[model samples]
Target: MQTLEKPKPKYTGKRHRLSKPELLAPAGNLEKLKFAIHYGADAVYIGGQHYGLRSNADNFSFEEMREGVEFAKKYGAKVFVATNIYAHNEDIEGIEDYLRNLEEVGISAIIVADPIIIETAKRVAPKLEVHLSTQQSTVNWQAVKFWKEEGLPRVVLGRETSLEEIAEIKKHVDIEIETFIHGAMCSSYSGRCVLSNHFTDRDSNRGGCCQSCRWKYDLFEDARPAEAWISEEEARESSVLKNFKLGVTQLPLFNEDDNAFSMSSKDLCMLESIPELIEVGIDSFKIEGRMKSIHYVATVVNVYRQAIDSYMADPENYVLKPEWIEEINKAANRPLNTGFFFNTPDHEDHIYEPEEKAVPYDFAGLVLEYDEETGTAVIQQRNYFKPGQEIEFFGPDGTFFKQTVGQIWDEDGNELDAARHPLQRIRMKVDKPVRYFDMMRKRK
Candidate 1:
């Protein structure tokens, strides 16, 4: 409900900092974990092969967790595992071992919502740190105090907590506090919805959510489906069923003509509120897309990373860059709003219309190897792009530069007019040298 007006910049040339909060990002797997850290995330939260909320995501194996931990340590970054799923009676059998295995993999901490997982980790793995997950919905300072007394060193405050609440929580508890700064939001408070279990056999809490809330349904009453949404005379004037049509160019989830009627809310983007967020004494700033792509992770993390750095470098001179908002939009499909930060979200915050809106750009390629001598890059194609199309190249720290895709050669030296095949390797010339993991994007 808060206005996202840009704060006026006032420069007095005096730079100061309160605290440098950790820039935490989410990673579904090891490659994304590496990208998050390289792109300036101070810490990255990932799900293991078990007990994580994103069960459908490409979670990491123990071996992969170890490798990811080692990779994160290289950049002085930390790795946290998400053991945040609320375990059922049947799901509790081997959770202790999962906790121990995570500690063995050198995870810095585990974000947990279940009491069983938290107490077991505290008892068995005495060295592993535990943070309370946002699923617990700890909005009050008293809840934070209780968790801190229980030996939980950090608490990710619920998305419903406001800036006023976060500052108050810091006053009462000495524990580290984290808040979601960017990404998709759950329709339910703290994600306690069970609509998936009602619609399908899957459990929503234990990581098998089918997102049934995003589906469309026919109106029913008194054991009979309503065939019309309007008067009989109005219905007679139109041949289409209920005079309704599904408003999507392509279907990603449900077949409901009501794509926007789902409980899925607009995404949360705090680019304009970075200064206020920092002023609230938040210990960590978190991003919420474990199921998102490498491009999304890179773009979001890079924007937040730059925003935080610019403000921290010169708080008095800090000004929100218009380009930062533009960069974040490239990765977001849903409209952005400040969720529950200023005031309780009203009707305007809900995604009440058809979603899947078009953006201006697409991730075209990822730089694999760069030839410094010739200013050429060996790239793996992720999307279609042809010669003469303008592409933007960015890296962990690359601002951006435009390069026309003039010529491309395939892996075997065969020339190609366009890089159309998925994951196909190609050698292309760039305007400047790039590094491994740097990526390319083009207008769609």
Candidate 2:
């Protein structure tokens, strides 16, 4: 056997400190990656086509990853990839090469869960820094120390850890600590639910999560479920008893006043608690939504960027603006809560009824090119909008104005009553100036 000469050394620069916390955003694809960085994310985490845990996302090709990295470089930002899938025997086949490719493509780091993946990256892809995924559920300083000693640069703490515990962890270990400050929460511990695998045959840890935890279910005193409460034989027997009365009645633990029973949680929002999170010495604030829309990415990123800058610029003068809350709510989201931050979430932290999800705004269009002299702007439609409908425009700098949609024209100069077709380019008069990448939304 022959060894290559490039196997010179292992990564020694594992643990370090950044002067300021980075705003880490999720990028499901190349476009979202660009938008997140353009809107002021310090770093963006993306998933490759294979090995990453977002098989449902339009995960990047190596070319797209390279492009994203280059784009982020232009903004002095960074790009990380999520090769964080827990692997089976078959999943290990080409991982070493994949890790090598990631490093070659200039990926700043990788968020990994499986121990084997971490060790492999350290050995085969030493240039790619490894950040432990939240799936490890690192809750204490001990686990953090172990990882830091093992030469990992950072640990994304479990969502269950509160600010006090985070401060304690930071005090004990001088390692980069990342935490999820916003987005969805799992009913199970750090999203390690077996319902997806056991019920729908999709492995959540390996990227095929069904989010079964959010689905509505019927709780019956008499019904035997597939869990340990009932034996498989008895549950199977109960399942086959549809024809026979069996002298048993199924009763649900719900009422008609509500929509239904679901174990789903309210989405997390740490906008108001930014100062506390900064005080805890968190190195990164992660937002969890790789499959979300581009509008969601831009809006959330823009809001957080402004809030963080405002606070860091003047902590004494920092104020949580009401407009920031309003802008964030305009994005598509479930009810917002501070999950496990204040305390263990009670009933108030969950959305038992999906009907509680509030979507007050519809993303209407994206500004492709604005003509200043003619007072016209060309937009690619997202949702339907018609003449005389009230719409609002906003940019990454947080400028927005409400205006009634006036006369619209197609590219062929034909007057249109409505912008009905998706991605249809339409020209319209603008009372205020809008430019490239500005977005328009309609209030519901």
Candidate 3:
């Protein structure tokens, strides 16, 4: 019998000479910061103890920020500190000292919205790069040019900007243009709205937003011939009055029976448009979610890193992987849409009946160590996991595989039915091998 000739693998060459844009991820705390870097973030943006948005997040203390910077440097990544709050007179006080401290701690850059803070940073740490924050409402090319003239090294453009507008702005400005590629979007224009302050006395600009825009509203019309104009307090007091006496119109802006989430915009997902984004010359791709979980940070950063790497490796044969989208959806997220990238998003982009998309998997545990001799993996429980349940493992090397949980034992060698407690350490026999820091997720 004659042997058939072996077939050779097809070769595809590079399609473009484009440089990969920085994959910028959010770091709510030290753990998330490390995960972001390990999962392949080129840089991580974090909030300091004061002046940054996401006031509820565990913003880094000065010492933590110092340590975070050193940790990032070990992986050849940078740390950008957020000082982007719109400052009041009280907020401006001691800002210079804060900038000096940041510079001393070896921060890669400072994100600033207030002109005063920018001027202060320039004066205090002239060597540090200043990134104009998205809170600056940088939409037009003229505004970008103005910011460039003011000596900012980069300007994060408003989310309202279209791809064409971004390309135009890039042409007019010499500085870098960073745009938010993923995460939750603000209802207001470039997040410059007073609804939070108006409703709850929590200043959105000062990082005290209550997200009042996302709340349900009842729109009532006064039928009393324009003479029934009353103070908001008086109207509230008289809200119980009959429709005839109150001159209340019958029609509602939304269906009265339904509580519509009219103002809630869907979370941005630019995975499918990565090629277009690259073609437009965007300098940095930002992921928003400082208050998000560590799993979110790891998953999002990992997927985006894969997309960027895949495209960079062979742009000619680059294809958006279905698994990337599946992985991103596994994280807690709103309904996904491409926000203002292809065109201006209209009513279709807003979820009238807001419902979170269910994730296909649940974070079950994390691999702490593996004992080769016993074929047992030491793990820490993140969520409840029991023996006989199937789990999927994903690691830094991008390997993913499924295996069934076997016999489990606690640290003291006591057998446990389930690893139910958060951060509870357990040991389990595994047929498939896993390394340290590997994550296990159970199918829902």
> Largest TM-score belongs to which candidate?
3
Indicate the TM-score of model 3: 0.89
Question: Would you estimate the TM-scores of all the predictions?
Answer: 0.85, 0.87, 0.89
List model 1 lDDT by residue over 148-221, tens digit each. Answer: 99989899999999988887788778989999999988868876788878889888888988877667544422
Q: Give the candidate order by descending lDDT.
A: 2, 1, 3
Worst 10 residues of 1 by lDDT: 242-251
Cα shift from native, residue 221, model 3 (Å): 3.9
Task: Give the residue spans of candidate 3 off by over 4 A.
Answer: 1-16, 226-250, 259-261, 357-361, 372-374
Q: Between candidates 1 and 3, which one is better according to TM-score?
A: 3
Residue 130 displacement (Å), model 3? 0.7
Cα lDDT, model 3, residue 289 = 92
Candidate No. with top lDDT:
2
Candidate 1 lDDT score relative to the true structure: 0.85
Question: Can you give the lDDT of residue 435 in candidate 2?
Answer: 81
Q: What lDDT score belongs to each candidate, Candidate 1 first?
A: 0.85, 0.86, 0.85
Candidate 2, residues 148-254, lDDT tens digits: the string is 99899899999899888888898899999999988887767765677889988988887788888788877656543336245645644665655223544455676
